[model samples]
Target: MTPETSAKLAETVDNCRRHAGDWELGITLMLRTHVTIDLTGGLPSVDADLAELHEIADRVGDRWTRAQVASAAGEVALSRGRYDWARAEYEECLRLAREVGAHTEVPFAIARIAESAFCSGDFDGAEQLLAEVAREVEPYGGVYDVRAYGGMLAALLALVRGDLERARAECELARAASEMIAAPPQLTAGLDNIDAVLTARAHGPEVGLAKLGPTLAAAVAAHCAERVLASLCDTAAVLLAAAGRSAEAVRVLAAATAWRAGHPRSVPEQAAVGGLPDGTRAVLGPDRYEQEAAAGAELSPAEVVTLLTGS
Candidate 1:
């Protein structure tokens, strides 16, 4: 469902809570609604829903519900870049899911743990967890989360290791899996970001920018996830910096940073900072770069989109 619809449903559910079961439904809906990347700020914080979930679990002594709560918490922590906490929560979710015969959640929990490892830069750990997810889901023709999310993580890990062929294969797997599930536009945008980065590395910045420009514009217009949007901006910045368009790089980077500051749960700032080339700083000089960045930060979303799309 769209984030807007989910937010509306969550609000309606919240007002109709008349019993413990209703509380559980309301809290789950609210958690799912608010945790979505696009509509986070209008609803209650995820922590409040999680706390209520925990209370519900304690009252009912339901291991399955507890496992669900852990998984939800893990997702929240991961989105906020708390890797260790996310891993711990996912592990608890896995353990409890197994105890409660929540078989469907097992592979998903493992995939998320792998995600935490990937995000934390522990590639080997991510591989191990992903392998476990593969084993768990293989008997069932593979789960969508394991295939799509895990494939994306694996592709990125392969890229970091400079294994272009493997990265391409994994990216294709992710793309196919995403298509099978008819994944959200934000997710497809993430796949596009990955593809653009790979293309930049293999071909040229101009070629990559040609592919990325439309996808980036569409993502911004769709109000995609902040993490996906940030990655797209960083990739654009990197490509621009590589192509010697240092001014454009600085503007995109600065606009992305400004946008992220308003959306606090986004990927960390350093992720974007590290993508730009050192030459960008030298080309503009530190003072001029900062001045341009400050100016760029004030650009409205429409202005930023126009700048990025060059239209």
Candidate 2:
């Protein structure tokens, strides 16, 4: 949706929420929609709605909505690269969901925890969690986010293991599932990341950058999650380095690193895929790489976009 439409919808929802006031169910639904709308635009100010939603759920004694609030909070944390905290929130969400006998919510909660694990470099744990998620979700055709992220995680794990064939197959599954579900841009960005890396591995870094460039631009334009933007920058750094653009690569890597640093406990993608390659540093040597990286660290997100897109 266009930014204009999204803004209008957000305004309308706020109006409805004011009118609904203190009506637990109506407020809950409105808050859910509000959160979705905000996240779709990659805005970072959903805490107020989430806090209010939690208060209502507590007042109403609704375990299911409580579980949902936990999941939503977890998503915010995850988007900021707070993997440990995100996992903790997801675990709470899972416990609450199971307590309420929310079968559908269970798989998605598990998928989210798996995503946290994957981002934190726990591929084995992520694999086990995703396997459990698949067992629960596949029989019932799976929920949108669950299928999309699960497939993407599986593909990423395959790539890490040097199993290109498996990676290709899983990436295809992720893309198809995302398309079928009409995935939100944030979810689509994750899938596109896998594709860009796969393209780079199969062809060359330049080809991979070609695939990644448009995806990165679209992601920035869509206001995807901060994690999405960081991951794209991470990929761009690696690909640019491989393609002989060492200075640009170092700068981009520095920006991505700076973002994670801002979050304190934030973790990047798996070190193998996301961290700047040592080879690139060796080529540039300490002095030049450090100079470029230091400059990159000072760049704002918009500046990073300009550095990348030249716009």
Candidate 3:
């Protein structure tokens, strides 16, 4: 991160913390900050940051606010690749939202729980949860704000399921909704563009990864460590392989593998392979590999359903 950007993010964090007592305003500020950090691919240093924010929400003693806090914490945990933890948070958020009659939060929490399931490779669970969320939220008026985020999740789920055409269509819908709502342009745009690039890659290798270059460059310049790392790993892998520089690709993958190993708790398994060359799996070996792989692979659909229900 640049000095200027670092200073700005620090200022934002401080300002949000200073106004933490007002649940509505605080949640909005925190959500904005979270989006910014997420786009830049940064993760919070500790769970306690989320816990502190939740503590403030609890003090407010409003059901809606508490649900929002839980949802936000679930987002943070999901971003960190703590799928089970994310599931737990969102489950609790859902229960509280339902109990308090905060219907809006119900769909939002459901969307988040679905994302956790998708990340953990429970595709059926993700689809089931999204279907339920869509149904619940659609009746409340088909507003772009609620549906936009859910659409993005749906697009991602489609991508993971190997339905490139469906994913592209859903991504276009998400992009349109995001644009309409004036969602954080940087984050949403990058994600939409990434989906496009991935779709193109699915067509052929020689079609090249050039289309992603500028966006990836912009992400790196933005100093969003998480975004930069993901973009670099993906873009470099494809470009290097296309250029016949498999050795460099391997080296880049190695560095990425090492980085993920270093931040085991923070980096997601799918993230490590996001934009890399086909057949270029990270040789992080049996022990560490099995640990993270099981974390992603062995997650049961039932567990996801239970987590979504928060029962």
Candidate 4:
């Protein structure tokens, strides 16, 4: 993690530690910090902290707060690429939300589950969950994040299914919903909008590459390591391939591979694709890198872009 991120997390942790009486608020703070860390491709220490916090919430018997904590944990796990654990956490959160009738939390938990499924290549399951969330949350007023999230998921699924037209439409909807939110741009709502725009262009590597330059620049300026690494890996792979810079693509992939090695406990479904280089694996081990190297079949430039961007 960056120094700034570490300091921010430390502040949150200190506040939570000092204010133990406010278990709900403390858990929320921890969850927010955990989410930010997970999204930025940080170290594994935060996951351990979140697990401890989860135990505390369970002991306190705060069902609603526990549900939110679980949902946030699941999201962080998903961001780290831990699909199985993420799915389990999301399922637990969903059950708790149902028991407590916490309508606001249910959609978010379901959306996280959908994301897990999508990352695991279970498009049908992902689509079903997203559709359910959209239906369930529609009657509840002011759930713009849910709506935009579902649209973003729909766009990804459509793109994977080779329905470019449908993907484009969903991206437009996501962008529109994002515009209505008053929250900070780094928040989930705004990020979903940015994701939609980038995913739409992912149909063509050239277009995606052109868009990624500015997007990565912004993410770097904001100190969003996960977003920057993701954009770099995807854009570099594709642009290099398109320009016949195979060696450069290999170099970018190597760097991404190294980053993943440092966060082995992270959610595997969300990590970069194409696995580590052979030398990296000799140092990091095969289990740390999910994908195996192919001898002759290199991914097309667009496919490389999709793998990196999760589009």
Collision pairs in model 3 = 40-224, 41-226, 234-275
Estimate the TM-score of every prediction. Answer: 0.88, 0.84, 0.69, 0.73
How many residue pairs clash (N, CA or C atoms closer than 3 angstroms) in each of the candidate models, in the order given? Answer: 0, 0, 3, 8
lDDT of 3 at 78: 68
Better of 2 and 3 by lDDT: 2
State the TM-score for model 1.
0.88
Identify the candidate with maximal TM-score: 1
Error of 2 at 50 (Å): 2.6
List RMSD in Å for every model shown. 3.0, 3.3, 10.3, 7.6
Candidate 1 vs candidate 3, TM-score winner: 1
lDDT of 3: 0.60
Which of candidates 1 and 4 reaches a greater TM-score?
A: 1
Q: Write the per-residue lDDT of candidate 2 for residues 24-70, one digit (tens) a residue.
A: 44355545543453343343466667677667767767777777777
Candidate order (TM-score) = 1, 2, 4, 3
Each prediction's Cα lDDT score?
A: 0.74, 0.75, 0.60, 0.61
Q: What would the per-residue lDDT of candidate 4 be over residues 113-147, giving only the tens digit for each residue?
A: 89888878788999999889888887887788777
- How far residue 171's Cα lies from its native spot in candidate 3, in Å, is 1.7
